[model samples]
Target chain A: MSVRQTATAVRGRYQPRISLWWWLTKPSYLLFVLRELSSVFIAWFIVFLLLFVRAVYQGEGQYERFLDFAANPFVVFVNLVALAFVLLHTVTWFVLTPQALPLHLRGRRVPGGLIIASQYVGWLVVSAFVFWLVVGW
Target chain B: MRRRRPVEPLVWLLFSGGGVVTAILVPVLLVLLGLAFPLGWIDPPPYEHIHAVLGHWIARIVLLGLCVLGFVHWAHRFRYTLHEGLKLQRLDAQISLLCYGLALIGSVWAVYILLFTG
Candidate 1:
């Protein structure tokens, strides 16, 4: 191998050291970080739902106990925070969806705003359906 | 020659599917079940109602989709978060294993609970 080729191969790209709290530097960065962090809470919500379902499966007594647990101040606080993060996740997910799944009609691409607005419409419809199933129905 | 298909697009499909499902369903569920029902802001549904709803095949399928896709979504995002946000790419293999491993376990647990328990 040529000496220049050997030198180039030996020296890799320079990567600047980044701090762990780099996301804190700007509002947008923080928002991005929070959106990423929302995944953890999403996982938490799944676990919460599983436990609730299991409690329901076990019967009335267990279900009541689960409700009591959920009603605890700490659990309620955690859930409130989780709700915030998940809301952020929903907003960011929908906004970004336009980029990931661009829709086309005829020959032209669909407007991003239209896609995002449709997502909100879908969210409302889905939420209403769930409300009907869980409470209204 | 037949080219080998990459697993990434499938993973991203699960991720996006999960994102859309959870985005639409979770917030209201959280408000109703997590907050309102527990706090008595709204009357809790009858245990029979909840039980009956969950017992239905459709509810089971929706829930299974939610849990399975949700975890896959979480796995993909959290994996990228560690790699990019925290700059932990050096531990890529281990990180991928840990994130996706937990997702797998969570999905299995959801399946078991959905199938066997309730």
Candidate 2:
């Protein structure tokens, strides 16, 4: 009705909309969020292990039941989601690891992919040790 | 019960080591735990035995340390992500209101789980 009311209405009508990909406004930010999300998965995976340990402490029967609970369909779905997060974390770490620990080998900046591969290789070595510990074969 | 600081160098060492351990353990643990679910691999982790391995005081310590480190890392990462990603900054004061609120909640969760669990 009044001029002020008309201006307010015009501004409301012209409010911006949020697009799905609009989050890409800051690629770094997106990467950061992905980093957080990935870490959350990493956290959850740890929690699951902790639960496993707790169940074991309770005794064999408790352990079996807890293990079953963890393996439920809901958990499987959660694990799948975590799998997606692992992929996100792996990619993000590769992309940003270089930044976190910028290495210069022989007076040249090492490649990011190379850095990531090196970490993967290192992880494989650790995994082998765990495999040995757990399976002992 | 309301401690905000991480434990110590021992804890930090445990944290660093834990990530590598998780990468190694999760798949195997998954396979081992899979027996409970029909969809899991036929060869599972022999639940009771693995539980025996994990149920020690030492195991609990390791898990708690790892969870705290992982959560702290996640919170710090998310803070920057929100500030940078989505350009939530473009919006008015009300938008940042929720973002800050979430950060507080995340911090509280991290502190609560880490301090009280152990």
Q: What is the C-alpha lDDT of each candidate?
A: 0.89, 0.55
Give lDDT tens digits, candidate 1, residues A21-128.
989999999999899999998999999999999999999999899999999988888889999999999999999988988999999999999999998998998899
Off by over 4 Å in 2: A1-21, A24-35, A105-113, A135-137, B1-38, B55-62, B81-118
Tens digit of per-residue lDDT, candidate 1, span B1-118: 1123598789989999999888888899899878998888998888999999988989988999999999999999999999879777567789989999999999999999998886
TM-score of 2: 0.60
**Top model number, TM-score:** 1
Model 2 chain B weakest lDDT span, ten residues long: B29-38
Predictions in order: chain A TM-score? 0.88, 0.67
Candidate 2: pairs in clash: B32-B44, B32-B45
Q: Which runs in model 1 stand beyond 4 Å of their true positions? A: A1-13, B1-5
